[model samples]
Target: MSDETPIDFSSVLASAVHDMKNSLCMLIQSIDQLSQSSSHQSKEQAEELARLHYEASRLNTNLMQLLSLYRAEKHQLPMTIEEHYIDDLIEEMIAKNEIYIEKRGLTIEIDNDEALAWYLDMDLVGNMLNDILINAMRYSKDTIVISTEIINDELHIHIQDNGDGYPQEMIDLIDLPMQDLNFDTGRTGLGLFFARMIAKAHKNQNKEGRIMLENGGKLGGSVFTLILP
Candidate 1:
């Protein structure tokens, strides 16, 4: 009689996600090289290649988030808090998706102070910001604004777009607990859940970080804010 515990499928899924993430990284690189090397192709071909690159990049980002969330649930995620300039972080994120932004004829406006710094897990926060920015670019009409401020002794980072705002249901759903999120619908739920978890991981003086989603900002569209104490 052989007695063995049942294998946890979740762990297997996590491992698969990690492998997929690595593969996607290579695939994105290849797509980038192809786009660059085949610049002399027809306009239609170029556009198609650009679309392929963007979708691959987005998928890679999603897989990374999924793997990180899995690690977080297992209490294996390590967060390193360090002092970093907000502007520097934003610049890196913009540069990362610069090609896609340019192809889409979109613009990003920065209103952050060059000297404003924060203590946070840069990798985690950067990933969250990049994902939010990528999603914003898809919905923004033309201009996307990235701003930073200090409000009520908490550091606030805002990403606003000049386009139709988020659907009312999504804004309402964010207020509920992550466990209550309906994953059967859209990617918004997963992205928001990951962002919320990352934000709440930071704490200081009994204050934890949080995120907010509101419509009707300076851009008259959707505004996403990350507040960290």
Candidate 2:
């Protein structure tokens, strides 16, 4: 028998997903432009536009998670760690989602020291934060609070939404590896899984980061915290 290994289907699948995501992004842009130019007073038209946007966003999120997981499995993911200002990161993230926030009448508050800097992989960390932000926007009533601080030698970032906190069962399952779940229940589980993976990947001087879920923050809602060392 030949010594060569079998073809890797995972890489092929990931590339396909990346291609599809790019196409979907183009489609979303076209739809957005059309929606902007064509004024429709009917509720059906508005609902359809909303549905298209939602699906596009969901697909993009899924594609991102798949790519991240694939890289993680191969240990090929780049951890480009750098020292960045926490406030600037929060500002940029909020600006990127301004349209969505305004459309949903949601308000976001950033509470972080402007001078605080930390070492991290900005792209991976940004993806993780974006996922958390999207989740907060979906479940929040009208407000979300993002905060950061340094405790001991670790940095802590918190994203909290003013919605009903996650049930105890859901919070308890976050640390475990990915598992099958019912889509009908409106749970992707990938978001948290991706967040956990990103957090664990961030390490400094032999210390690693961690993610935690809690309730009863300043927002009186669910809090997703990332602790980095």
Candidate 3:
């Protein structure tokens, strides 16, 4: 018999999930077009369609996180750090999310120094921000605020919302590594876990990036902070 074993099941599963994500993207586009063309007279139909689109978008986000984590664990993920203007990144994200925010009648305010530049993996950072933005969208009451600045030689980015904030249990769990699959808060905890992993991946010289949770911010909501050095 050959030395090589059968095909790896994990690899197969990852590939399948990747394919499904792409298909779901197409599905979302189709649904979005249909929803845009439909008349607003059918309230129930429009609400159902909106829900379907949101769920599909959420599934796509989860699949992406899974794939990225898989590649990261295998040391196959690329980390390409480059100097980028912080304001441009925030602007791009806001533009992409405008519709989602408007649909919920929420307002987002971004505060940052116009000249601040940072060296980091743009793609990974973008994904990390995307996850945070999605979480804020889901939990925020009416407003979201993102801010960035340099403090004590470290770059800090904060995403905060105007909601009741996270439960005490979740704040406590931020420091601990993810070791359980059974979540009691009805939250999957995947986004925070994924954010932690990405933050830890950003290292410079001897310093590594970190993520933290706090109860109070400008918005009086849960704050997700990422620090990179």
Best by lDDT: 1
Q: What lDDT score is found at residue 196 in candidate 1?
A: 95
Which pairs of residues collide in candidate 3?
none
Cα lDDT of model 2 by residue, 1-229, tens digit:
4788877767787779878978997987876776678785366665566556656766777777788788887887768889988877788778656546755668898889889999888878887887788788889999999999888899999999999988887787675665643235453466777888899888888988999999889989999999999
lDDT of 2 at 38: 72
Model 1 lDDT, full chain set: 0.87
Query: Best by TM-score, which number?
Result: 1
Q: What TM-score would every model get versus the actual structure?
A: 0.90, 0.83, 0.85
Model 2 stretches astray by more than 4 angstroms: 1-6, 31-51, 175-187
**CA-only RMSD, every prediction:** 2.2, 3.3, 2.8
Candidate 3's residue-wise lDDT over 1-229, tens digit each?
A: 5788888656886889978978997887887677678756365676566567667767776777777877777787778888999888888777655546656668898889999999888777887787778778778998999999888889999999988987887888786766753356543477777777788888888998998899888889989899988
Model 1, 49-158: lDDT tens digits are 66876788688778778878887888877899999999889999998787678777788999998999999999999999888998888899999999999988899999
Clashing residue pairs, backbone N/CA/C < 3 A, model 2? none
Clashes of each: 0, 0, 0
**Candidate 3, TM-score vs. the true structure?**
0.85
Which has the better TM-score: candidate 1, or candidate 2?
Answer: 1
Cα lDDT, all candidates: 0.87, 0.80, 0.79
